[model samples]
Target: MTSCFNEMYLQGAVRPPYARLEGWTRAMPAELRQMKQAEAEALFRRIGITFAVYGEGGDPDRLIPFDMFPRVFSHAEWTRLERGIKQRAQALNAFLVDVYGRGEIVRAGRIPARLVYQNAAYEKSVVGFVPPKGVYSHIVGVDLVRTGPDEFFVLEDNCRTPSGVSYMLENREIMMRMFPDLFRENRILPIDSYSERLRRTLASVAPAKCDREPTVVILTPGHFNSAYYEHSFLADLMGVELVEGQDLFVEGEYVYMRTTEGPRRVDVIYRRLDDAYLDPLCFRPDSMLGVAGLMDVYRSGGVSICSAPGAGVADDKAVYTYVPEMIRFYLGEEPILNNVPTWQCGRDDECRYVLEHLAELVVKEVHGSGGYGMLVGPKSSAAEVEMFRARIKANPGNYIAQPTLALSTTPTFVADGIAPRHVDLRPYCLVGESIDLVPGGLTRVALTDGSLVVNSSQGGGVKDTWVLAE
Candidate 1:
């Protein structure tokens, strides 16, 4: 358990609640638990809560593990995080505009041009084009966690295809059945209207010349990646068609999709695929997960795409350190949220500092996620640390280090009963003409005894976040 908490802090997960009530000690009746599980399964069938996952032999269906307990947050804490997230999203939008339009920040040396041009994520296709609403990244998910009673730090910014909102809604429904008495008594915040916010944001960025009721499609990568549930869920809730890469095409300056009737004009696309897989003509030429000539149509102002193509460059971990500065530089306001102390390996002084403190710090590869390319101090072997040291020296620009944090813990339900598990919150944001962030978001938990990795791909699970009624 000590090692788990130690790793969690090292990895930058939000500090969890300290108190834990274990087992049947605080659990509801067994019959209640079973009833809740059954009720949740029924609700899943009725509401069609799904994410497409490819099973062996190429079959695909939505699959997400739903939990019955809803993590509760006070309004006071939530409001602060919301303000910070909106500010961050706005600053990122501003940064994207500068990068693609003027290259002002890059030329001014505020950010490295090498980082911009060399990153696999950056694109030259949209350099001169502007979005419909002058906005990119219509949806952003900011990962956060409570490290203490009031200490919540910003983790990652998921501007490109951030998912797991469906889990938030479905988890809450399960909780309602599993712990009805506790839920009723506790002042949990409502998170049912997220899809409404999403729909509004998507509509807000429709093409200026689009018809009164613009046709929006959710572009997907065809059921192999995780978080496919969120893709279909948002599409169903928004009442839009969910399309794969092959279903779309570009004709003239307008983008269109293949329907039963024929090619239909598409004004806005809520794309769930990454940049490289979005348009083969614009990005990786060999990618079959993209439509040819799609970028040209978007560039010509015939269509709008969420999070635009090059938005990922701004969400990089190294780029994150400059966010507060970006907020101040662009918005002329102080940052509402704080970032954990960071060490950029590219800087000589920073690299020296991190190397000296390797025994007490956590290091991460700038581009990797799901807890890969991580080294935890106080837990790493000498051999492991040396290997990481060499890796950092080899690609200093791609590595960063920070002091391990003691992420707070919350009481989580497990097979052994209730125990303290590290947890983090990822609140969703919709940035169109304006910022529209949902009150409740997904609360991911590190399910291992004391392990701090909370990614679903890393065997982590989730809980529904309940923002208490104000």
Candidate 2:
């Protein structure tokens, strides 16, 4: 494998963005570092900031490992990233509105009709209805990976309810508490307004029927869900009610939350549940996690759903290959950020190439997330490679392949001392009245030696990301 780019050091010298951190890491003794690490863990545990990993034994509510070292970005670097992210978000929303309404991009042959109309995530029920502000995906989480100083590629786009913003906020909070001097020394941008920004974004899309201050509620599956803590945490931060299906009901023309002081009208719903489990009467009759007839109210402009139902189709892995085309067709502009070159297994030629090079490429399921159902070919054994090969051959349309990228590395604190670890970033972009994102994002680091995956569910840890102010 080729040597990856080191974000902190270049040509044996500390990079400008990370220069200040060099002395800070060098000054801390091993004993003091260990003590601070323990304190951070204790604080996370005491605050109930834990996540559940499905199908895992022993302690389902596991605390995700938190690394003390932070990932830093220069102001100029962040500016470029921010522009690209916002552009992508706008194009995605435009595509969603067009596909559900007129299918302009599809008609123009910029993207395949089958990829859009026949997608499993495409909701036929939402066919001609446009959400308020024409924004189907209110929040967009674009996963990015860096390979060189000026080379960055989008790994994937999360148009549905994206988890990990809680981690972003918590990581910063803990870092500020543990190293107050770092904040005093550096002009790092503040991300404390993220919750308020999110709240305002949700409220901005209130349906036309709402005349008063729109009531926004976060609709969660339940406490047993893996991201339950995040659901509750966001609710607390935004000062909104976090409710389940049982706590809400659809009345004559609107949905209402059952409160102690009678049922309160809800105008905007920031749902954390999947589309199928959002409305039993519309998608799945057996789904008890959603309110019945809620889709009716949503479609009738009585209420609004952030990331409207059908938004997932825009982020489908197979359809992802056409996002750049969507940008050109919808926004008439070139994509600011490039997508990692992807080969769809659904195509016969691509399938043959992937089969022949199973040991040299990464294969992933079209709908998989949390780093599951993926094969990192460079790090896998022969048996694992053959297994994935067989699976891809059996069902080609269920997968896509990409070359194993030499993901960039950042300074990380390990048991021995400071070292470099592969890392990725997921910045949350909000799209409502306007598209915007905070300066920093959640930086997931691969904790295992020579590993590339950085998902919390896959034993990877997180670090606070910093963007220095100009």
Candidate 3:
């Protein structure tokens, strides 16, 4: 039997980082644990911290399952991970800048020109104009999974609007409220400053034309869109207004928010909508989600978009294979964090290999997210695999495949008892005048016994992550 690496234990002994949790888990009775879990759920409901799962039939706003057991890491472990994350974020922004400006990477043959020019995420609207501070991706979320005690790999990059940061904050708050003693016993780093730091990062990237204090706002697609809770929650935390498309208007080169007082000039927009929906005049004509003339204002330096539309080029699944080369070309340093070896199905030989070994690999669409449009070869039945094989054959350019990794497991609080479950981390990296991230991030676990997917939409739950203070 192939045993998955357990994060909390080694040779049946508790690891140093998880030593403090040993007694807490033992002293708590099952009844008390159940009661606390119920209390956590009630608190979530009262606070209105719920996510919308569209097409789920019943009540759409459902609470994401929260686990009491925290995933712990030592100070040294986090320091290393932090450095790698920062390096990756810097490289991503550099690549975005180069692709939109010089096209040097393409000329040098480091990345294919078609990969950028033909990519759905690439935009030619703001080609000549650069963002303030030249930072294209203001906030970067890097998905990571571990396979051993000292091994971690970057699963994917989220350069656009990455969600679930609200969960990170709420999880810590709930944990502290429920078990203040556990926090007191352990020396863990504080993540309370993330909102303030995020605000500062945004303000630092205000457009050059701004003379007064920059006004920041969170642009949402409204309550109907998923991740609405996060949009409203972040706005409240950052002391900014949460506005829909109808709430804002653009005239003569500047964007403004309609207010009871008057038209308020807005300088920075942390938009949560997609690129095509950003400007009906520029993209999807029927979209009521984005401001008209917003892209033109952004190009003219009248307003600064948080991610600067079209930053998604860095995170495209096909573009991911060239990140290591990007690090070398842009940063002049080898990658500290490794990407899981990927096989693009667009290639004839690779596609042939994938079809032959369909049962041992995981295949995913280039544009897939939230665990949808994917196949877990080992878990799928014959008919499902055959269906996927046909789908791949029809459009080979739309898919990528990777080996089935034995993701490390963490002890989770389950119905029967504590059991090991696969988990992954998504640490949000903020880029602007400076690059930073809160010490801990959202730790998602596969709620099912042996499953590997950790997306909330796929029945996964979240756990608070702890980076022990030195």
Candidate 4:
């Protein structure tokens, strides 16, 4: 029978309808599937994976868009990846602290000092201040793509307010109903502890200068951010106050957040706003979305910011290629996960080589994300290639090129029934007293046929990842 996979793990219920689940089986057994559908909706409601729409001010709850099927990962696979990611984050954290504190790497000429000062994300305000526990990046979401059997590569690192763990939590709940039999029968690693882990991680670095239990706040950029659901979700899960930029103020040496009860001291802030928008006084004076003088208070050690400002430099596309070396240099260990083959445009030789092979490489803007400013080599038109060639020639360092990779595919339900689609996983990790990784991650699928762009902004849908027992 043609099921998604061998259904021997399914208990009680009949094996998944692998063969018969074609055209007629969809609607004819709608009610039977309705049981699964109803259960999912009910679970979602109970879990409250809701988004707060702007117009609806009072009971602002909107259901997160979710799918029934979950992508599964083996425990052994997760163990290896978990170790790799933790080590990678640790190294990056050390790099950020050193970059701003002593400029060791920059002085050593590993990373250009001009690049640091000129980066759109770099914050000069955080130069002298050290973060609590010396942890600059507490939460990190590392994106990974499978190119072939047991071969995975790092797509990017989401260090500044990396989101999507809530979706991971909610997705697990949905999967339980969609495949109740499998969930009950198979051994699935529970991801329910993610929120708690996040709380501990945030709490761990609470203004080490303070003696009391620190109040952690989830700083959001208001509601327009695409990951607003995640911001609110994490806030609710962590039982922390969710504050927008305007809801905060910096007074003298400390930062305070507005609440029904006047102003309350904020010991730690898990800010989701980009570094440029965290403090207008420090970075961009014209920015209305940032708190004035917020960075001053943070630098004074009155409050801790998760992933202290300027952490983005480590995630720079060019710096990504050097992560393995950084891992070895800092951690004295080999990276368990692999990096995708990347061609650095900053290198004169690599730029010439990339230009010659324009039609076969995936050219990308180093600074952009969410699938913006990217050109798939095999899919680009002649005009596009010519435009990129000129753009790269003028500013080679602004771009990076990688060979087109055939990312692994998973079967997903679509208009044409179940079919294989390219997918990638981004797992959220919390670094504190210890490392905690959510068992499942956000599984993004490229909806268009043969389309490699998988950002949600580029019409990608998310699936709940399910790590099944061996």
Candidate 5:
């Protein structure tokens, strides 16, 4: 009915990649489906895989719905995505290294100076320092949306310690557990190597002072943070210790993790905490979530941060529009992927256009995440649009606007039957000595019949993403 591409269907014919699923979806019984859904929920509950949603009434910790249907991508399609992801990661890191150390891109006038140096996410503490291996965002989660058969646009880039890989891995694990026969029948590429790849990427970015095999640890903001489960999950998968700020201390010039075997010198940290709470001495003096002088040790090259501090500057939504330019400027190549045509509300003309078309645009805060501080104009009421217009007028620089994308849909199971729901893909590209990722990624689905939001915080669900073998 909609113009958006139905990934599973085209002109009443099943797409080649999804041909085998035609019978699978048809043959699966509703009674068995209901039972399996309950079983999956129990499996997730038993595994303790849940996320915390802030500013919500009642129980904040909730399980993200998991769709039994797997999202499939062909090997060729995945290959294109993999290349684009790596290219984008390399360009963004190069931009970070340049922005922190030099003003080359700014001098070239490729991107506005205020967008970087004046941005809240930019850290003055890391202005002249570069992380080991010149990697700013060690893990890049590039969010992609499809509108047509061959048209995939990158919605945005997650440069600073992107989460949800745990979901990607867990989705596959649960799928195998729930439907082993399906996996056996399909020649899906394996994503089990992600944790091992992550471990290697962390170790590969060890500081110059680390002479021995790097002792990598995941630094979490205790058990109360939203992504605490992912922090512990990745740590467990990587066979590393998960420590809080209290467990890590800076001594002399190096960071040491408190262990049962006494203080173990930490060479690398896969930090899940934010930059503001990373070091109380350097950023927020009143913060209790960070080490006293960890930044000092980090700047002194004692240990490496997986995503170096100040990496969020590159992740800013205002700076996102210049990513293709960053690719051309830094990588000396055109962007392999396309960015959705975005309107920076900071610009007078763009702001005017966005204000005039508030009813049809999707406006989001430049620094907002987790599906908060966003307006989906088409789905919003007139009152909501008016409220958003006033908010944008008051602080135009805080927002960016883009046309509502006709996000592609896939066959998803529901209480009634199989239906089409909007979905998005977040491919995690690990950057360190080299850029690599498992073929599949976290395929987030807006489970509601006509919704477009795919963030779990907005009532979205996860599905196993299967990148079929060649």
Candidate 6:
């Protein structure tokens, strides 16, 4: 088995980024650590910062575990990551506009035509219509995993409604509240401005019809949805209305929000729901979670959507393999961050190779999220492998396989004491008239010993990410 890279320690000495944290961890007593952990959990519960797992019988709302140990990065490291993230965001938005308009990348033989037009997430309704600012995906959540000090690979992209930024902000808030001296000691960058930046990004894409300061509202799929807390949290932070489909209605050309004062015009909608649930008239007619004729209003330039209607195609796992090519084709630049080596099961040779090496590779559904519908090969039993093999053979195009990467680890507070656990980073990059992201991102840690998965639904925990100032 390959050894994982430890982010905090190297050769019995602490890494530069984590030098300050070493003494902090060593000085904390076990009883005090336990008390702080309990206090953190209570705060999370009180704040209602919880998520629900679908098809589960347990409590509908569960608090994601919070690790007190923070993951740190130096200024130089973060500068490189920021550039890569912004570059990827630009390429993704450019790809969305290209694929929906002239299909230039497809016509130029840079990417497969079938992959763009035939995918399930592709919407034909907005083919010729260009969104405001030509930005389809306003918030790009790029999941990154590190294999070594200088090797960071984008695991996947979430161009649609990506959840977890609320956790990123809340984690830092809790940490600052608990350890006041730590904040004074370490010049960690501030991420509190994320909400304001997000609001500005959304407003920057308001439709041309709006001549005044645009009113932006977050469209949520009701409280039953898993990310309901995030929807309300962001609304409160940004001072915008968090409304469900029922709270909105479509007029002749524009959409309006129902308020006690009157029917107020909504200019920009930061929708947190999927495409199929955005407009009942255009998609999924039975969907009560979307407004009727909302698509028409959006297409007619009455209101703008944060991530335009057909943005999902750019984030498909199959399409992810072509992102580097997209950077070259669209931006005429090399990809700053690389993609993990992938094998598309839709191809005959790749499918055969994946079937033969099912136990050595990690396989995931092309559209899967929240850590579901995946097989961690090394951790699975023979029966599990056979089951996945049969599923893959039945539908080859639905799967993609990649080598099980040795994900880097950070110091995490465990049952016995501090230990190294596998971790991953998901930085939410905002795009509008420009592209930018906060210094740090949400760092998820696998709480179980030697586990590679770092999803909250999969028993993983989150840690406050620190990008120290220069």
Model 3: pairs clashing at backbone N, Cα or C within 3 Å: none
- The RMSD (Cα, Å) of candidate 3 is 0.9
Over the stretch 1-470, how does candidate 2's per-residue lDDT look in tens digits?
23899999898999999989999988999999999999999989988998787667778799999999999999999999999999899998999999999998888888889888889999999999999999999999999999999999999999999899999999999999989999999999999999999999999999999999999999999999999999999999999999999999999999999999999999999999999999988988999999999999999999999889999998999988988888888788998899999999999999999999888899999999999999999899999998998899899999999999999999898999888899999999999998879999999999998999998888999999999999
lDDT of all the models against the reference? 0.76, 0.93, 0.93, 0.75, 0.92, 0.94
List the pairs of residues colliding in candidate 4.
Answer: 2-18, 2-19, 3-18
| Per-model RMSD to reference | 4.5, 0.8, 0.9, 5.4, 0.9, 0.9
Question: For model 3, what is the alpha-carbon lDDT of residue 228?
Answer: 91
lDDT of 6 by residue, 72-161 (tens): 999999999999999999999999999999999999999999999999999999999889999999999999999888899999999998
Give the CA lDDT, 0 to 100, for residue 304 in model 6: 96
The list of candidate 3 runs beyond 4 A from truth reads none
Order the candidates by lDDT, highest first — what do you get?
Answer: 6, 2, 3, 5, 1, 4
Runs of candidate 4 with Cα error greater than 4 angstroms are 1-65, 107-118
Per-candidate TM vs. native?
Answer: 0.88, 0.99, 0.99, 0.86, 0.99, 0.99
Q: In model 2, state the lDDT of residue 177.
A: 91
Off by over 4 Å in 6: none
| Segments of candidate 5 deviating more than 4 angstroms | none
lDDT of 4 by residue, 90-149 (tens): 888877788778877777776677666677666676776678777777888899987654
